[model samples]
Target: MRLRAITGFFFVIVMLGSVLLGNVVFTLFYLALSVFCLHEFNGLVKQGTADPNLYTGLLNGIFVFLAFAAQSYFPSKFLLFLLPVLLGSIFIQELYKKSEHPFNNIAYCFLGLLFTITPFTFFHGMAFISGSFNFHIPLSFLLMLWANDTGAYVVGSQLGRVKLFPRHSPKKTWEGFIGGILITAGVAVILSRYYTEYDWKQWVSVGILISTFGTMGDLIESMFKRSINVKDSGGILPGHGGLLDRFDGLLLAAPIVYAYLYFITNA
Candidate 1:
């Protein structure tokens, strides 16, 4: 528990500090993390396999960085052009390599990078938006996820009698799941009053959805880990596991919440 808390604190401090610095700094940090995460992800895929020497991990890292930079700086048309170009390039490369499972590793690596980095584009977008509200959007994103996770832990520990999904995650319970939503919604209302222009009703709605779906994201990653018969994604952090283990919920929650913010708000 102490180790987890320490690691969590370090993550929060570094993340908030980078965001406060500016978009460019934040983008650089995110780009570096995206590469690291993609490497870890591909390593997982290639472990104990015949295709361990594949360069799909390196290529996927490059693709993620390029995609993020394009999405942030270039026009949508450029993005459209880049996609097919990248796909054809990867396909041709795989064909030339001709491993036993030539396409499988590359396809999965590319998809993993996409899944990991796209949502983070929203954080970069948030930092670019004009506002004098001290720019709490990034903090709010992390806070909401934290509230949901912590609330689920405390509440579930106290009153988790009914299993939520024993097959996916035996430790999860329906009561704890609802507890996470309520806590996240409560935090959202508070954030709405201070930083955001959103109404309490909308905040609550978004909060509940984010929390529920975030839990599902955690479960989905857990399912992947279970299928692969691994204990944790990696042991990079002290007690928090890997990037996947820590940010599993955000993989799903970030995109959903970003879409809600984009469509629901006039900003």
Candidate 2:
């Protein structure tokens, strides 16, 4: 427990610092994070018999993220053209690399991008959600997600009786699920006071989405880990597991919440 708390504390500090420092740090930090997580993900995929194209996949991940990051910093159409070249390079390279289950390799390569790159691209796009880089939206989103996670764990450990998803994660409970939502909603209320871009109601709605989808994201990752017969994604975080384990919630939550913000902002 002490180790977990220590890890969690530094994790929170670094995450918060990355956002608060400025866009340069934010971009660098998350870009490094995306690559690290994808690397970990690749390791997980390779444990099976198929080998994913690490370099090409990493290139694609880098390109995809930089493409969006560039747009956030400065708009350009020329950067958009690089997508096909990078993505197509995966297939082209795969054609020459002789390996058993070649198609499986190709599939996992793209899956890695879909799994890591896409959502992260959307997350980076969040800073520009208001047509400029303001950390409030991204920072608020993380806070709410963390709040939900902490709330669920505390409540689940103590008051949990009924299983929420016994198939994937046995320890999860309905009481904890609701507890998370309530805690997230409370955080949203606090966020409302500072981030007036959206009122209390919208923040609360975002909280709900984070708690709901975030939990689903956790279970989905659990399902993936179980299918592979792995315990944690990696040992990067002491008590947590890996970057994947820590940010699994962001996998699903980031994209959905970004869409929600986009829709409302445009609507």
lDDT of 2 at 258: 93
> Per-candidate RMSD vs. true structure?
2.7, 1.0
- lDDT tens digits, residues 1-267, model 1? 998889989988987787677656777887777666666766676664535333655664566556655555543556556766665666677666768886675667566666666656555555443332234766777788889999999999999999999998999999999999999999999988986566788778777867987898899889878877787889998898898888888778877777777677644
Cα error, candidate 1, residue 69 (Å): 4.3
Instruction: Give the C-alpha miss distance for residue 237 in model 2, angstroms.
Output: 1.1
The local lDDT score (0 to 100) that residue 195 gets in candidate 1 is 69
Clashes of each: 0, 0
Which residue pairs show collisions in model 2? none
Candidate 2: count of backbone clashes, pairs at least 3 residues apart or interchain: 0
Q: Candidate 2: which stretches are off by over 4 Å? A: none
User: What digit string (tens of lDDT, one per residue) describes model 2 on residues 121-213?
Assistant: 788888888898899988999999999999999999999999999999999999999999999999999999988999999999999999999
Q: Can you give the TM-score per candidate against the true fold?
A: 0.88, 0.97
Native-to-model Cα distance after best TM-score fit, residue 188 in candidate 2, in Å: 0.2
